[model samples]
Target: MKVLLTGATGFIGSKLLPVLTQEKYDVYTIGRSNLDYAKHTKLDLKDNFAIENLMQSLKPDICLNLAWFVKHKIYWNSDENLDCLSLSTKLMKEFYKNNPNGIFYGFGTFYQYLHDTHIGNNLYTKSKIKTYEILKDFASLSNYKTSWGFIHNVYGKGEPSEKIISYLITKLRNKEEVFVQNPFNKFDFINVVDIANQIFYAIKNNYIGDFDICYGTSFTTQEIAYMICDILNVSKDLIKINHQSDQKFEISSKPLDIYKNINIKDRLCEMIDNL
Candidate 1:
């Protein structure tokens, strides 16, 4: 299968590259930087003519888009969200126009499923929600085989430092005391590799429509901290849990047990030891 991938350098997308190649996919990546692992084009996606040319040239059987404006805490309301929204919509339209029989998979955030009372005013969430709405119409007109993977709290190597797992690993590895807010708030985290695997499984099996990319297990921030400390063989006393009401804006997403044998602790240990 020929696959055209965006955000090939991102956490989840990076993992997908290797997986797709091993599955015999002719992966062509679009990004700002060069990647020796796949056929790559360093093109700016904002250039509409360039994007249209690439789509007609590649006409890939699958388009995996994972690019967007994302920062630590500001993405929820960033002005860049609007730019991403516009760019993604244009990209999808061009792809569907060129290869009406191909597949398009866009990564969405868990915030898309949160109650309106929690994220109704959120631009990032609203944009993602809107993107899926557009995707549904496109699928109807095309091959009717599109995918939107709703993801949250992903942890693994190369993950952003702002995430709780990365934050705890950095602090605990240094043997420094770390204070955790939302200690009791439950969150389910998936390893980036597992996330990539799940995505490939869906594409390979021809699964369509909206799906949640997660482990279907919830753990508190404090619990994750302790787990990291245990893996590092550090004293658990370094974990200071702050008392606060849980952020109940979580969504109960369905878990596809594609990687049921995945061990979270083992992945954590690998990340810690490699540091």
Candidate 2:
């Protein structure tokens, strides 16, 4: 299989490429930076004509898009949201027009929920929600094969930001105190490797439509902190829970139904241990 991958240097994309290449698939990666993979291409997706040219040249069987502007903080704001839809829509339309049979994979955030009313009042969440809505709309109308993966907290090596698990591991390794906000609030987390594996499965198996890509376990930040502390044989007392300044968004109670297809919870701790 020939696959064109965007955001090839991202947390999920980085881990996914090695596995896809090892499976004997020709992986063509498009990114701002060059990387060693099945193939390399520098693509500025904002340019529709350029993207169309690349799609016509590569003639890939699949296009896995992961590129997006993201902020680390949950409550941060950005003016980029105004143009996010235009850029993504243009890229998708060009890809779909060029290769109508090619599989189009879209990445969405699990935090973007409609039923769950206890949502965060932040621009990041709003933008993710808007992007997800567009993806859903695209999947519904597009003739080509389309799939959207709503991902939760993904942590592993090469994490762009210092996630809770990364922060805990660092603090424990240093024998220093760790501070966290709302440790009691439960959140969904997934190992980046597992997420990558599932992406391959979804493509190979021809999974079509929207899917919740997650490990299907909700653990509190405090629980994760203790898990890391236990792994390092450190005192849990060193972990301190701090309160957020503005608001208290309730824990994510969105029940993702990935259990019917696959779940990566069993290997969660083992993966963390290896990290």
Candidate with top TM-score is: 1
For candidate 2, report its TM-score. Answer: 0.83
Clash count (model 1, backbone only): 0
lDDT per residue (tens digit) for residues 1-275 in model 2: 78888887877888888888889888888876777754787766566677778877877788888776665653246765545556667667777777778878878776676334444455656766776677667756855678877777777766643767777777777899999887666666777777788788788788887776666567778887887777678999998879764443443433234343344334445655666
Error of 2 at 17 (Å): 0.8
TM-score of 1: 0.90
Best by lDDT: 1
Candidate 2: segments with Cα more than 4 A from true spot: 71-76, 81-84, 114-119, 245-275
| lDDT at residue 54 of model 1 (Cα atoms) | 93
TM-score of each: 0.90, 0.83
Candidate 2, position 273, lDDT: 61
| Candidate 1 lDDT | 0.81
Candidate 2 at residue 259, lDDT? Answer: 41
Candidate lDDT (C-alpha), each? 0.81, 0.71
